[model samples]
Target chain A: MPMHSPTDTPLFGSWPRAYAVVLGALLLEIAFFYGLMHWFA
Target chain B: MSSLDWWILGGTIALLVLYGLYKSRGKQSFDDYTLAGQSLPWYHVGMSVMATQASAITFLSAPGQGFSDGMRFVQFYFGLPLAMVVLSITFVPIFHRLRVYTAYEFLENRFDGRVRSLTAGLFLLQRALSTGVSIYAPSIILSTILGWNIYWTNLIMGGIVLFYSVSGGTKAISYTHLTQMLIVTVAMFIAGFLTVHKLPTDMGFTDALRVAGKAGRLNLIDTTFDVKSRYNLWSGLIGGFFLQLSYFGTDQSQVGRYLTGETIKQSRIGLLMNGLLKVPMQFLILLVGVLVFVFYQFHESPVFFNKQEVERLNAGPLAGEFQVLNRQHQGLSAQRRAAVLNLQRATAQNNDAAAAAAGDQLDKADEALAKTHAAVSDLVKRNNPAADKNDVNYVFLRFILDYLPHGLIGLLIAMIFISSMGSIAAAYSSLASTTVVDIYRRVWPGSTHNEVVVSRWSTIGWGIFCVVVAQFTNRIGSSLIETVNILGSLFYGVILGIFCVAFYVRSIGGRATFWAAVVAEAVVFVCYYFDLMAFLWFNVVGCLLVVALAWLFTTLQLNLRPVRVADE
Candidate 1:
């Protein structure tokens, strides 16, 4: 087995934070689009 | 086509091809040819990943979907961001650490060669078939615009892409993709702006959007939970997630794109970029269609978008009936235009009762217009029994040709062709890479000396096979985008299932997974044949079936052949 680094920073502070931001953005988008749909309709 | 239009289209494609080849020029190595030496920057990887996923059909047919069916289709991509996060966290680091050429190579590492070969075989089959659809999409543009035989256009389209793909390999494909995506985004944005610009002068963008919304073309989200409904929030999150996960993780076409990143971080960022952007990109494309739908309200829209079918109907015995239907369609269009204007004014004035009346009138006019359209479709079918009744695919293209200025028309057409080439090149690159790395290299382990040559030949061979498959694309009716996705849903699930077990269920051995995949695939086919549910669910069902069956099979195998306690 080869040693690999685990502490590399992504967009956010850490990998888990980055994943959370992505999921958070998705939730925000869904909520926004859902509101936009009813607003326009 | 005008001489200027021809010049614009030809110049753009030639420039892209030459530039890609120039940028890709380097010393040959097997790994470099297949994976771009694993040195592409995140931006290049991200753009390449987007280009590989957004084929010409996405540009051509997605707007038509929006125009006819509304923006509910955008929900289909809602799962993509979640899938990207999953892929970034799980798939990227593992594939990077393993230093595998193909995603299937990891299957062998985790299980054995049989599992590897089976997964690779499935990827090849599905990718080859879908690549054929991608090839056929641009061929439709050429055949429709130039009045040429689809067969010749298919060959020309495939052959051109193959030349660049073979010459520059993955690096060339990625380089061209950067330019392709830039052009696609700018051109599509222009198309949307022009669509609203061409609407009635009294109506601005918001008014047009309101008009589309009132007509049900702005259905961006649906909270309903119906298994049979293909595009809603629930199905999109669950079904679309599985589909995107399988597509990005297991399908070599997409895996090859992200795999070219210089490091695991680059790959993860590239995928995350795609996740963040794909939904908005699809939303804007479909929004263009909605705007087009509104544009037609203020203009004399055609009863049928496919001019070839209309021309055939005109030349046939039903020409008289067609003339009568044409007059009825014109009357309905005029009435609908008036009703739309009335509704617009009523809504603007906040006259709820009057607006309701106008809305009712507009709906009736639309129903009448749809009836006339249906009659034309029937006439088309009567003229040629095999003719596709769904003209949704031609909706946007017809608008561009008939209404847009000559140079912009050519640019938009070129944009479609460029997008198509980017995806087809990537598909060919991945197919050839898998063939050489997984199949050929495995069969003849000592032939690594000539690996580059073999991969190049594999590219040519698969290109030919895909072109041949393109010939049958016409018979598959309805929206070209939906048809391609449906074809994917049938196979993607089982492939994803096998990988899910490989990644998560550590105890499921190779034999169990192989047989589980085989059985799950058969059940999916049966379900599809029987119309068990909407196509998107097939992805979820197929994946879950495989995982469950793998566990069952593993437990059974364990019980049947008990582990012998050696020296106890």
Candidate 2:
């Protein structure tokens, strides 16, 4: 097979967008966990 | 385990082995065997990747960690999503393009054979050591449940995975992972649900969380900046990032997983999927652990969860001392249970003052209970020097055996076994591929040996090696999950640093990178040996040290030639 170059992530529009979504989700999880601890505590 | 449980467990294993053999029916070449012909789609790649990392250590030890340490351990994974993002952006394209059999092959292309071998060697060592530790985890389950000797269980655990891996190669391992992950996901979810379901009808999930929170078990985040702290946000973010980066980017066990994807997009998307799901998955698992903790508060709880060790001490010459501590433990547990019930009623009535009072009593009761537990552990150790003192690994397993419904218990045990199988099989395959492609192929440059046969032999050799490693893993100081990460931290940073210099620092050459890595590893060792800082930081420190040392060494030699791997 020919050597691959950077490929688009058609699922999330593009690679950068996919990364954004994952990282964005992480930030959201951190926020959610903080909220969870506070509400439970 | 009931007959139904036995059937579920037996049927699960048989289905897995048969399914793997079925999927990998056709004859395969070295490429097909090691890389599954690089034809798998993103979902297969995604779950396959997930299954490899979700070893028995993850299932048995992580929940146990949740029980003992609370959600603070979840911070250890905060760096994971970011690392996935970084890998998706950088490593995926390069690795997919090069089409190498192992991540270490890229090192060979970028630096030279020595660097490749050294990095691969480190991966082999750490991965083998960690795999052995994980293998020992499920063996604990079998030994506890069946009263079988652990040596036999370890051998059996390692052999079962070897059977599947040798027969199906990477394709079988990945295919089996598809089913293994499905059962694991479902069983764990049901377990969490049942843990909550078993609570008194008046108490719901939120109430359980309240109880756990008041007990300091809902500590989800710690923004502490302490260097010596193990699982604060900073360590998880920075230290975890380096560890995750090295694990996904350099470790052949994981790298080999993504390499099976048909396209770079498949690999990237699959990894991104892992990033998306892993944290939530871990959170759910930890929540189950916290719920198990809550379960014990309302019900009876063990002073030490390792029943085998507890039993031995209770029946030994120290029986008298253990009985006193056990009685003390029972009284403290009753007080704690009463306090939690009061807290529960106070919360239900919206009585903050009463709730606060109850929480205070609960804390005091826990302090007494903890002291009793410590005394018991000390006595257990004194009774038998070889007994495992840290019983966190047994917390979840004991709860399942004692509390979970029977058929589900069988399924969950099967799930842990299968989870262990997925990881061990992947480790075996990676070891074989690395040994065959990086070491064997390179050493005998023009030899047209049938590599598949050699790879099979290599798998057998590694399986035995890891099983031996399992035998020696019982003495690990931390929970098995943390022990695995600690093992990874020891080498992952230096490996990632070498890759960083290769990828981004063109002015450095192979020799400088090599010596720099050697010195960086020694420094990391000293830091870990003397407890200079938490283990997670070892990744960050080792990686930075390699890059810095490589640059310094290169500049000192005045070798200003830009770094270029073979592809360029």
Candidate 3:
């Protein structure tokens, strides 16, 4: 396997993209949990 | 009753041992032994990380937690995924780029040698003791179910893990973890299905949920911010976040898992996958417990879950009082079961008035049952002073043995043993690595000769140390899960503080941070001893204290630095 250089930027470079991915994940978690609580409550 | 279970158990052990030895074949180098030559792909890293976290306690106790306290424990992992994201962004890339063997190694380069050694020492102490408890946790279940001596069970459990860990090292541990996790996931899912299946034919999965909810076992969230409450949403998100961060980012055992990733991206992805999956995984496990609780409601449960202790109580002077409690327990259990069935029926028919009436009756019956349980536990303690009086830990285990078929029973029991081995093996490997790399090499400078030999001996020594710790673990109550967390909270904050200073605080050199850590740790100990707050909050308090104290000492050092330089 080829190792990425330490200085090489990852594919998801922009700060906005990073923030969007994190935010989307958080929202997904909340929605999934909400559904679980609803169904199992 | 059948030969299948013995064959399955023997075959599982044989396959695991041979696979471990096969994967372990490599050069006799310390790095290869400790890190699998740092060549594992993302899947191996992911499975290894999950297996290490999902100890036997998780399978054995989590459902019991759900049965006793409800699903609120699932909240504890809410912060885990977020912690993984933070670590991926900050900790992962840095550790990968630096190419450090242990997380503490980075502390030395960023700060000073003392800081590195201090953090490593804390990891050794906490992980070693926690691993022993992990070994002891499953041994209790196995010993209880199979009627074997607990002491021998501990030795066998610890010895099995040590065999593969010593022989094959990290590669063997990871490969076994991958297989172990696959088996565990399937077994646990089957266990959950069986728990619901054992309920009355009319009581479907939804009905079980209604009964569980009515009994308050489906409690998944609490918005309350009370520091004393252990598993509320506030603590799970905030306090759990800090704990998970310190654990994955700073703790060497977990760091060692990701460090083996062939590339930084693989490590990050593996960690991120854990963060995403952990909460749901915990929720599913806890949900199984809720189902077990429902199963007991419709069926007869023991007056006391731990049969041995109950048996001793029956044979002792407390026999009369225990008999009365047992009768009361049976009456209350019958009433509660009827109420639970009625509530399920009412809910299904959408009869609000009937459901409400059944719910009230169920609550009253549950209160009587709880009192009976307490009385029985008191009798057990009065009879045998050494008895683990908490029956909550034994709830799910009792259900498994009494209800599940013989073959499945053996597999689930073996699953617990396998889970224990995966974690104990990883911990043993990590303990050895830190001792060899951080303390031994540092103290005996220029002793590169026989480094692999030294590492092997260190693994053996730490394995024996952990087994010894396991021997005395029974004296510490049945709250193995809580005990491990409390122990970690005692030291993680100070360790995290040292790393935080190393990373962000440029002015705070080794001496100031070291002394600050000592002081912060003392304060944390005092807080715990005095019972100022819940144990989970200790993680937050300890980490903040280190950061605050380190800044204070750094300012003092800076002021003295100018005067001392002028004098010189």
Best by DockQ: 2
lDDT of 1 by residue, B1-568 (tens): 6788899999998999899889778777888888888999889999999999998999999999999899999999988999999998888988998888999988887878888899899889988999999999999888888888878999999999999888987888898889889988999988888888888788898888777777888788899898878799989999999999999999999999999998888888899899989998999999999998998998899889988888888999999999999999999899989989898899889998987787788889988888888888888888888677889989999999998888998899998998899999899989998998899978988764688888889999999999999988887878989988998998999999988988887767787888889999999999999988889999999999999988998787744221221112
Off by over 4 Å in 3: A1-27, A30-41, B558-568
Worst 10 residues of 3 chain B by lDDT: B559-568
CAPRI-style quality class for the chain A–B interface of candidate 2: medium
Pairs in clash, predicted candidate 2: B506-B562, B506-B563
Docking class of 1: medium
Off by over 4 Å in 2: A1-9, B558-568
Error of 1 at B392 (Å): 1.0
Q: TM-scores for chain A, candidates in order?
A: 0.71, 0.71, 0.65
Per-residue lDDT tens digits of candidate 2, residues B1-568? 8999999998987887788889878889999999999998899999999999998889998888888789998999999999998888789888887778898888878788889999989999998898899789999999999988888999998888888888887988888888888889999999999999999898988899999999999999998799899998999999999999999999999999999999988988889889999999999999899999999998989888888888898788999989888899999999999999999989989999999999999989988888888898789789988778888889999999999998998899988988888888899999999999888998898988799999999999998999999998877656888889999999999999999998888768788899999999999999999999999999999999999999998888856343455756
Clashing pairs in 1: none
**Per-model i-RMS in Å?**
2.6, 2.9, 4.7
Winner on TM-score between 2 and 3 is 2
TM-score of each: 0.96, 0.97, 0.94
Residue B113 Cα positional deviation in candidate 1, in Å, after optimal superposition: 1.1
